[model samples]
Target: MTQSATRSGAPERVGRFELLVPIGTGGMATVYLARTRLIADTYRYAALKILHQKLAADDGAGLADLVAEAKLASAIRHPNVVPVLSVEEDEPWVALVMEYIEGETISGLIRAARAKGERIPQPIVGAMIADVLAGLHAAHEATDGGKRLDLVHRDVSPQNVIVGLDGRSRLTDFGIAKIDRTNATATGLVKGKTGYMAPEQIAGLKLTRAVDIWASAVVTWELLAGERLFHGEPMPTMLRIVNEIPARLRTIEPSIPESVDEAVAQALAHDPSKRPATADAFRKILVDAWGNLADPAEVGRYVQALSGEKLDRRRAQTEEILDLRARMTTVTRHAEASARDTSSSKKAPGDLPTRLESGPTTAPGETGFASTGSLRRPGRTRALGLGIAALGVVAFGVWMVTRSGANVAASPTTPAREASSSEAASRIVVFSSKRPIVAVRVAGRTVESPPALTLGVPVPTGAHEAEVVAADGERASVSVPADASQVLVPLEPATSAIEPSASAGAAASARPTGRAPGRLQPPAKATAAPKDPGLAPPPY
Candidate 1:
């Protein structure tokens, strides 16, 4: 679509990769459809994603992010995730030769079909996107340590999904995808595609795995309804996300089954805690029952109704989901994939699956990813609740028993302040206010990219520090330490938490500019020293 991108600027060859043809281009880079010309045709094909020439300017922080993404993406190996083969920097372009996936984007498929007055098959659409969700789960769960890689496909939309000839749906374009735990983080412009964003992501809250699950739900909605789920050109789409309202599936596409509408509602639940916590969990909710988008006129009525008077599909669907969920059989889940099980935390009274994170708990009976819904004795709910409380005490005993003197010395005292708990790491310090601060280093540079300030991060030990670097790069802060085992550094209260929600509105105000970095002016200063991390003013 973008004219040839200049033949002169394009590379003749890259790491034995032939520049066969350019497939697509976005705000970040140009993707080329090409084949790998190895010594012997290993029967290889790959896509070459070359950084845009203008992006290399370093004027905006985008180039730095791309460079980091190249390194991060190349390190990850998964079938669902398009592999990054190699990276090289040319004079004018930073080129990355990657595994070229030969297929049409879901967006292209949708557009072609709509133009021809045709609709995509619902089951095929669901299957196509179901595979995409699997890929997201693989990336989200990928990790080298106890921490999750936490790769969030910020942009989960039709444009990023590819339906291959093999009928497998593959996800490409980590361009705007964010690896939350990585040392490098992207600020300024919002990451992710329009029409698909989680409420927290929309609010700029500390992003969790739940955000991706929420977005995946949106993408699923789009594919099944044969119409835009969060429809409203772009501005309205953002409002639709930030409004903290739930959308009904039946209204989005009347043909969708009632059971599916309920599942979709849970996936799109405004509260992150209410939504499926993991992609695997989300995938599990979707039985092959919810077919994909092949029905065209099914969604047309809703659009027509919108143009006239749309009914209360939004509110009705919410109640329906709650009613339908009552029929779902549920029991407390025992985590298996994780090394630590914190099922000690209790869920709010409800039958829907809820996530609970407690201080590290012990589980000698740990399995990689398998557990049963073994039931407890009937009419023993009160006793079971008491057991959980007692388990909290036992978990402490387990921690003390498992820890060695050296291990005790190595652990921090607080979530973000103390170097070691046993080493008297108990003094907690938080941002007197919510302001922009870059983490120069984290836990001897092995932890992960910490928040500008400690907000949602739980302190395993008593204290720890996030090395804050100054804006100009002239000097960095000595680590800001917090003594509390956990801290919540909320910047701007919930009322103002939502950014203007307009890309253009943010462009002039929050967009990284030619001036020095970290020039962001905090609207207010934090004062309350959170002995246990107190909340701060909402972020604008």
Candidate 2:
């Protein structure tokens, strides 16, 4: 890994996959460019989506939603849909391993075209939407045990459709999809993008496969017109979808064929019964109207024309990660052997289970993870702990390489002892203050304060200097105790010329507390006059 990569705090590995770089971040998870070794000198690249640590710890619903997404998406088998290879749950991390696509999202394509003052070709638009529709149709008609699953992909937009350089357009991100038997989405909760939602969906009516058709039509219209079909705030956008009539596609772009325009308009009909009954039927109609639908090869060429530089950069990054792996194989092997010895000889009572025990392969239902009673399967061992141990070993090796001048091949015999002591003795310094912190600088690194006011920085067992910056631009320097796990900083009011109170300053001087890291304690309600009234107090 490069120095910049290290500064970004990217992990070396998560579970069995080595993380290459971050690809994308969403509301509840982050997707990484990752690879796993298949055999000696052979590997498979993947887009690994891991749930956010904060969300996993605080919200059961977030974890349940991801589990539901993995289960539903993994069931569909289609060339036009991205495949989910596996779902992994190791404490502090739950990830979905997916086939990586090297290309741009339709959203990116649209933005690039708009910036260049060009509209996407009608045939390309037709072919891409047709491909998406095929995937949606397969999902809608999917079955388990010879019974229809009755799936509805509630979130279908340009952002969720990825167009690979290989000329294939695949539908992705089933995070908000609804399965009739599962009820993954809660009642009365609106989940999809406002601009692409169908009228019934915005109104909280029971959804059907037609919602996907409606969203696909909106994407088609945007591709041809180079503007959003519905543009406004959430409430107004919903109202426009429900009560307004969209102008004909040919009105915005007269070059578009009248037949194509009519087909898209029909699909955009507000009444579910008025739209095409199925995604496949809508696809066939659009393709026939297009008359000369571009093949995947042509679509791939167009995508490359718009995003060749980005694709090249991504390819280089992947190569670099692979090269780094090749160079570190010897060190990785040594670390793994050391971890195995440690695991066998010194078993800690609280250590995470070494494997995920497999039981029945049941589908996720209404209660999500609860329906399965646990995230783990009941019987057969799957070596999850081995993956975790490998991650820790790699982490220890990387730390050594960073500290000892990057001679990765040196010190084959040192990891076993160093890993034990360094891993055990490492302590976290949790910084807290009564004022809103903007950022914290420690050990030559500065990190913005998270939503939680408390910032925990892990350090070697030694005294360190911490600089805290408040939202009001007041700065304080404090010496953190080598042994103290928690410390409180003091800050004076922005308007005050006086320094912080003596008692507060005394508290700031290396106060130790038994509070656990990453747990937010409730804050007392403030009754005094507020200076930065717009900013809410951190939930501790």
Candidate 3:
């Protein structure tokens, strides 16, 4: 288990979702890092946002709002808009499950920068804002069935925009979104953050996509100014937004281009019609002003540099989770075995489920097998069959062991790796080979590579004899302690000489100075530690 696992006990289940860790919490909902199985035994990560207990107890009205948010966001399938998978109805608790974005919020990034007595690069900020606008435009132009959704994201604060580690900016949380077809909000009630709210929104006037346009402009202003664009109490802030603009905005960043300032000021125009006609227009203006700076990879680099420690801790915690899953699998197998043994002694024929009661119908006068009724006897024939099946299973297991070249230790020698505490359960050695690695023997267990390169293979921390054999009979052996995070084995064919890439060799040989940065070494070059365990934050 990772360190966090010991500190906070992992929740076994939250509805049908397996809660891995608590990622973030807000006034309306608490988000959890979770995983759920999809089709074909595949699993996907998701952010499960469940309404707070206090809110859920209010006759389910709050739950309805969550459902509405999911519905609204699900309809708009843009890359920049965070995707909502479903609204799960777990009894007594409803959750809005969204595509798990493995990255920090823009707000979190700003806070981290402040802590370091620095600011995010201006170009990066401009790029992120552009991405947000692109997503907002998609939502505005979304269609429901054959009709336009006419969706307006009323809440477009920094908290709502998630900058993923993959360097993409996604707009999330459409809980307060205004739709033409539905009226979830009352006519005169105000919504959205006070400082970022538009004049029309503050007055509870009829809203269009321009409100989002206005909020987006305010966010860009804050990013550049390094402070809130509007201040004071809520009422005063609303009045300021309604009646005035940031007169000192031009003076806030002397280095900012004049054209950029003029564009932002236009978007913040008090009159909605005077603002850019659509989010796309505003985005175009900003992109031109910023000029050739939107690289998702840059955002990815900044996030990794800022959150290296937090991410490492998460990775360590993930190891514990993987170990737990392995244990659960073992338990399930044992239970199945016990059930099969019990069924072998069952006396009642009716105990079988409805599907097993009948056999394939025989063609007219074609008798390849006995009738279903004739096979009902559970005495000598059944016992004999069970014994034969058990023997066959054992023989298969033996064959598998032999085929994988797993041999019991002839004599107890020195261990290969140093043993770690419970934390080691999550620590694994990742391997990437040029050729197909057919079998990997680690800690007395043989792991068969599944068509793809085996990234994370758990080996106990201590002296361990690890061996890798390729499909073409090429083999490589390594005696390494599990204490090291990763090990690279290049199983080249015996006849041909294999040359390793310089970068990969350097990465493998590089000694640890401190906690490494989040960027992984190129896969072709070196075998780096897994950035994310199978259920971790982001792939990159």
Which candidate number maximizes TM-score?
2
Worst 10-residue lDDT window for candidate 2 reads 1-10
Clash count list over all predictions: 36, 2, 12
**lDDT (tens digit, per residue) of candidate 1 on 60-129:** 4566666667766765666667777777565555677666553556786776567556666666666665
Q: What is the Cα-based lDDT of residue 521 in candidate 3? A: 17
* Higher-ranked by lDDT: 1 or 2: 2
Q: Sort all candidates by TM-score, best to worst.
A: 2, 3, 1
Highest-scoring model, lDDT? 2
Alpha carbon deviation, residue 377, candidate 3 (Å): 34
* Better-scoring candidate (lDDT), 1 or 3: 3
TM-score of each: 0.50, 0.62, 0.59
Give the Å error, residue 64, model 2.
1.7
Model 2 scores a C-alpha lDDT of 0.67
